[model samples]
Target: MATELRTAAVAGSGAQARPVILVGFQAQGNLGLGYLSSTLRRAGYCVELLDIELPPDDIVAAIRRADPILVGFSLIFQFYIRRYGDLIRTLRAHGVDCHFTMGGHYPSLSSRQTLTTVPELDSVVRFEGEITLLEMVAALAEGRDWTGIPGLIHRRGGDIVANAARPLVEDLDSLPYPERSFAPEIVLGHKALPILASRGCARTCSFCSIHTFYRTAPGKVVRTRRPAEVVQEMQLLHRERGITIFLFQDDDFPLFGKKWRAWAHAFVDELHRSGLVGRMIWKISCRADAVDAELFVRMRDAGLYIVYMGLESGTEEGLVTLNKGITVAQNRLAVQTLKQLGIMFEFGFMLLDPSSTFESVHGNVAFLRDIVGDGSAAATFCKMLPYDGTPIKDALEQSGRLKGDVCAPDYDFLDPRLDAFYQALARIVDVTGWIHGHRALTPQLNWAWNELAVIRQLFPRLPDTDAYEAALRNLTRESNDLLFTVVENVATIFATGKGCEPDPQALRRQCDMALSRLLHERNAFMARHQTVLLRALQQAAA
Candidate 1:
């Protein structure tokens, strides 16, 4: 059940409290909304978060229970836009329309279209909404002109006007830490908290909308927190929430290019200075070009367990097509460096894109075999997905290769044969529910990763530490073997689909059998170790 709106004391005498409700899908924890809710509370506006993930009926029930004066939806993905529209209509039908606003990636780019389409949404807040939303809500509460406010789009007597883009928040440290404590129902078992050390990426990857999203605003593309502030926040979460693992949500966590070295050193220094080095473990994402072996070693010692690198393509031509700006050699070096340093890493590969061909696909498969190997590490590969306001999408539009609306474009390959293969592979994978589905390779990898984390918590005190470590190593290696075998078989089907009349039915059956075996083995391993693992954890804590 949704909680009732609690009142807060606003400025001035006898001011009637007007509560704010932030609505979003609970796919994962809405950290953006969490930050917004905290910021609102700091400014004295009563706020409640209504995150609906399950049945549609729950959404209406939550909205009715809150009965807020203002509702803000965090519109990040275009897929959810229709669902949000339905939600707004339901609220309006119930005669509950105080104010409706939305902000995030999708709305920031298509504000006019969103407002015009979803008539119930009164206004759309533009990029970096924390400050803009706080001010907008305050103005709306006191009957002030919000039109002058920068970073807002609203309807004005049959005219949709978008105010000037607001300057990027220079001092990110001034903002309140996101209120993660308020949304307890959605918290997962691991108690792994997601923290952002920085915002935005400096890369201009043609496939990404991040760079374009920030192009309108004036200032540096990437904004980072002072290292001390980040460590302090981590320490606080560690102490208060009993969270031992932190996941850095920065687009390019190691920061990018030559600038990251100094920042990394300072960050590691603070981790040690604050005594958080021994207590907490973290994971981050970065580009291949930005990795330095020595810097990574320091980070590993300071507790970085996993590093996710975007190795978008294996062939240089594919890399160039995506505008990744890094060579295949650079990616190899980064992967080799991590392997040498004994750091666990994963790769994000794009095997199929606008420029992918038979030769490139073969090269990508070979590359996967080399870097990823038969059974060692975890990696995920997929075709490039186009989004609104990205360079690739724009190019596709100009070339007439795109179908569907601007919100969600369906793209065709440059080569019809390649398109056919992709479609066939997609169908097979979807039907088998093994490759890219929720229970696919990535989730299995995540489960192994998380299980190891729990095991590591109890590593220091286990009576048979050496034997236990051996068992973990064996499990990890076997897990990777299963993942790689499944991936290779799937890749063969796609890589050969264009040239030969491969038996996709046979291939799909093979994949299903392999995945079923892997899941059964994994479940057995977990069941076998459950009692001992729990005991070890308890012993360590005691």
Candidate 2:
């Protein structure tokens, strides 16, 4: 099948094209579907996307309107299984009876569970989905059996059968550019879009399934595109679509080790050579250990405005437990390096890891204080979930501490009080409601920082810009302190075994106050410069 796929495989040859409908989360550019869609279209098949966020009626109507031969669901997370199942069932009820398939880490890593849970799916396209999905669609169009294809799981004779998986695509550059025709992702009145310079991550963090997902197949765990090719794509997008903000959605941008470091340098050089160094800005997510002042400075010169690192834990024990293989000192150094570099940084943190005690929780909070206390970035966190294909999940299962089912998997801390503390904190975040979501202070500050990055790049000499940034940073610090104080208080009460009535109203009041001030400052800055900003943007678009 692999040989056949590599040889002569294109989905449709009919004079009237057959449309393959892809449905998935597209809030942040669903590159999974984007790539798949491009692959199908490149192979002479039509593809349409139905964003899952749309109302069910609209989704059903769109499917009906397209009348695609196959509907592929991008079930990226295990928790969304029920939601996808319900959606699939709804589709069936509406008499939309096209073939249905699902793909992603959850469906790939646990095919049996995925098939069993989402029984409505005709098959699961496991692992890297481009070739598998394309081949499946081709087989369906050509009236050939797709069940025997590589990288597929399907039901046969009331029993689930898993076929051999295809090796990961070794040459990422060979793949067509991802198809991105959705409504433009606008960031602060500037056009934004996601692009990829590489595919896959080499790290084996316990809570992350990326490494496992890549290693599940028999190929390179990571693959890179030529730097010139990446720059060419950026140039094309900037020229054709007027995209000024490029968000590299690679699992982690290739910037670690000798090979990846060279790739990063080549990328920077290409950015400069292609005349995009001063014309565009981009963001990337990377590991803390990958941060080097010199390399980041070069990247910043190449229009790198933001760096997001996953600093999973603070305590040495917590870091070791999570298999981070980096030190608290390294994390701090990375934060300070990027801070001094003046490149905005955000982070992913786990307030509660699988191994947690009251003392460690406090240590984590203190770490958050030191890193984000200055409000360079807003602070936010949640307890880590043992996802389907992570080492920590297996360990939790071995220790008999893993709770909940495969979907919505969770584990209680060894200390019951820590669990209580987590619940109280969750209640505060959920009820007071100004903490984690898009409209919350954390995300608000994140957006503000993004806008500031744009302004800093476009209008470098604008008057009072520095003051606005300083004001935003102060608001961020206050917001971070408010969050830290609330969490610490809850932790202390829970640790000392004190009966306490947690009042989220206080949290609500503080958050509301902070948010009001943030909005006022942000609005004032915008009002002061909207005319110039608008003119600059309009000319750029022109």
Per-candidate TM equals 0.88, 0.97
Maximum-lDDT candidate: 2
The Cα error of candidate 1 at residue 455, in Å, is: 2.6
For 453-528, candidate 1 gives per-residue lDDT tens digits of 5455424444554454445444445544544454455556565653443355665665555556556665666576
Off by over 4 Å in 2: 1-17, 499-502
Report the C-alpha displacement of residue 142, candidate 1, in angstroms: 1.2
Q: Least lDDT summed over 10 consecutive residues: which range in candidate 2?
A: 7-16
Mind giving the per-residue lDDT tens digits that candidate 2 earns over 359-463?
Answer: 888999999999999988899787889998999999999999999987679997898878877877898888777667777778888888888988888654678
Candidate-wise lDDT, in order? 0.73, 0.86
| Per-model root-mean-square deviation over C-alphas | 4.7, 1.8
